[model samples]
Target chain A: MRQFTATYKLFLQHQITKGRLTLISVMAAIAVLLGFIIGSSGGDTREGAVVLIMGYGINFGVPIIALVLASSSFGQLKEDETLVYLWLKPSSRIATVVAAWFAALSAVIPAVAIPLTITSLVASSFDFSLAGPTFLAISLAVVAYSAVFSFVGLVLKKALIWGFVYIFIWELLIGNLAPGTSKLAIKTYPTSILINMTDEDINGDLTGFFVSTPAAIITLVAITCASIALTAWRLQETEVA
Target chain B: MTQQPPPPSSSQQAEAWPPKDSTIVARSLSKSFRGGLVALSELSVAIGPGVTALLGPNGAGKSTFMRLLCGLTKATTGDIWVAGGNPRKDAAVRGRIGLVPQQDGIFERQQVYDFVYLAAVLHNVDDPQSATLRALELVELNPQELTRPLGSFSKGMRQRAKIAQAIVHDPDVIVLDEPLNGLDPKQRRHMIALFHSLGEQGKTILVSSHILEEVERFGSHIVVLSKGRLAAEGDFRSIRSLMDHQPRKVKIACDKPKNVAARLIESSSIASCTLHDEETFEITTADAGAFRKEIAIACQKSDSLLSEVTPLDEDLESVFRYLVGER
Candidate 1:
């Protein structure tokens, strides 16, 4: 527990800063303003808000924030050669991986969740129901995205670029367009969960990405656990600089 | 060539692990990296408590050996025991071994105090805050400098911070790879004193350096590696003597150089003698001390003044050259 606290504190300091915090807040405002614009421009305010949440929040904001935070968790340390200090510690390898994962999750969660939830609320014209489900979906997405990206950060050198590619090509492109390939993209699972839990149809866009709640939960949990384990195993076996 | 560790006595076997005499022991250790690169090969050594210099040129496997001892990388073959148990398999054993690597891998954005404190926390020190302060103090880092980001620190200050982190936990064994690199002369002297003080406390310190003079300042004990092999071990003087086939060159200044050369050539210890000028003679001998004494006696008998006798090939540089074949 002490090891986790120390690593978490240190890793968090690397992530959270005045500029980053302000940028996240701005992203949140952008989401809210976009939803308001889409609503006041033409159609139902609730529908417009739900469309912005699914379009900008889930498809863009959440994954981008997760990628940045998760990749920075281990990638920065590895690049700086400071990973040796953490690797030489008496803490269990699992603890190290999990601490990094949690730190990334903590950073991305706020940066992503508040913006996403506020966008949903403002888009829906202060409807609590839409905001609540968006919050749940954002929470679930952050966990899966943080774990998978953290694993990539540990395993790859240019994790940030690869993370962006995965977000653009796999999550946004294949996840929405290709029918069966959505299973390979982490964004699909959280989108499926949000669709199943919420009433906002948003032009029936969520129907194509729908999966059973149990399957979505099981897949997310599996990806998170497996990625964390693989990261810990790699750290144990590899000779880091 | 491999040298077996001294067999443990009955009392030692019956007592606890580590055998008390040895702090680090590697048996037939070897490491092969990817792409068919073998960094270390079939090397065996036992290191006791004190300052032992690890001397080798680039790609000599010094860094690999240190990493193996610290459990950062596992050996491809054989085994290693650091501070009593296997650091590779046991976290407890790793806690007792501190390593200051050669690379500049510091958390540059972190404050000096936070960086050292994080190390203390990772080592599971009893009181991390106090231990951090003490470690910084030991490294002689000013109290005001503790809060500044490490990126702002000069190279010497960064080196001291690295040393502070390594010694923060007060481990039983400390492996420092080129710890003296990039330090000013005064800082170098201070670090040498610090290493000597740590050794005096019975802590095993294995420091590697490219500077022979600095290594000499540390101690006489050294482990020399060449081409991923243990070329020589023990005091440099003994190793130099072991390589007796190499001729020792000595320059002598005397009043009658031709007379001295003629008389010195008759001695069995003198391999060859050449008269350089009127008052100087260059003599190559298998034994320098005996030849010096013989020259003194010969000059006394002949009424010739012997001014100076300098042994040209007795320092660590010559010994290292002979072992590594750099000469």
Candidate 2:
């Protein structure tokens, strides 16, 4: 526990700068503003917000926020050779990986959840059906994306560049090209959670991406656990400078 | 033609390579990088407790050897045992080893207390706060400096901070690579004293340095490396005696260069002499030890005010080359 606190505090200190906070805040404002515009139009406001979230939130916002913060957690540590300081210790490597994962989650959760909450409120005008499912989808997406990106941060140099490529090529492009391939995309699970939980008739565009709730939840858990375990393995196997 | 001796077998290496109450041992250790640059090759050594200096030129694999021992890098081929356990395989064994790495990659934004405290926690120190304070105090860093960010401190202060963190956990083995690189004279003395003290307390402290004179203060036990291979290892005077047989280039600046040169060659020490100026001359000697002793007496006899006697190839790097060539 002491090991986790020390690693967690130090890793968190490197992130959470004024600039990142401002950027995340700006992204949230954009999500809320567009959701409000859809709300004022007065036609299927809940369904409209879900569509906006599915397009803007699931496809872009959640992944981007996760990418920036989670990847930098370990990526910057490697870039600067500070990883050696952390790597030399007697503490379990899993604790360090999980601490970094949690440190990233500490910021990612608020960064992701607050904006999504506001946008859902602005779009649905205080309805649980819209806000609740929207929150669930993003919350699940945050867990999966943070774990995967944290692993990416540990394994690759210029992690953000690779992260952006994966976002574009795998999640956005390849994800939509085939229904079968969508099962592999990280964003697809949240897309499923959002579509299957909400009014299916209203989300005609996203209705095709829906998988069963059990499958989506199971996949997200599998991805998060696998990412954490793989990260620990990498920390053990690779040589530190 | 003279026959070159065969390479020592692994068993022979265990007995011969400074096996003074041996604790850290590397057998048949070799490491090659991606681009075919071999960092360490067929290196074998046994370093026991005390202040043993690792001498080599830059790119001579001193840092690489240290990294492999600390389990920071994987050896291409070899087995290393630290404190009766291979640090690479035994994560618990790493708790007993500390490293002051060559690269200065510490978290510079954190205050000194935070930095050392993190190391203590990672090492599972019983009371991290007291341990951190004791470490900082040992390195002579004042209480007031604890709150300052590491980047804000001077080079000497930063070096002490690095040392403090390495020693914070009080491990059995401490590996320091060029540990005194940035310290001032006083700080270097303090650090050297601290290392000697640690060594006295039964801690194995392996220090690395390229400067011959700087390392001379680190006691007599030494290990010399050339191009990733063990050139020589033993008492300092023993290695010096081996090197004494090599021809040395010596330069003298004095009042009577000709007279000094004339008296210096009387004992067959000088192979040849060349006078560069009225006050300066150079000589190549078959026996450096003989010439070193003869030069001062020769200068005094000639009634010359001895200004300087400099050995052109006396640097540790040059010494390694000379030793490697002779072997």
TM-scores, all models, native as reference: 0.91, 0.88
DockQ for each of the predicted structures, in order? Answer: 0.71, 0.71
For model 2, the local distance difference test gives 0.85
- Which digits, one per residue and each the tens of the lDDT, describe model 2 over residues B1-327? 111223347867765553546778887899999999998999988888998999877788899998888788899998787887777767777888988987877787899999999999999999999999999999999999899999899888888999999999999999998899889999899999999999999999999987777787887788877789988887856665566567778888999999988887777878989999998999999887677788879978999899988877665546656776664
The clash number for model 1 is 0
Across all candidates, the chain A TM-score values are 0.93, 0.95
Task: Please provide, for model 2 over A15-90, each residue's C-alpha lDDT reduced to its tens digit, 9 standing for 90 to 100.
Answer: 7778788879889889989988988989778777777888899899989988999988888888888888888898
Error of 2 at A193 (Å): 1.5
lDDT by residue (B1-327, candidate 1, tens digit) is 123344655665674333457788876799998998989888877788999999999999999999998888889998888877777767888888888989987887899998999999999999999999998998889999989999899988999999999999999899999998888998899999999999999999999999999999899899998888888888998888777788998898988888888888899999998888889988899876687689887898778998988777879999998889942
Question: Evaluated with DockQ, which candidate comes out highest?
Answer: 1
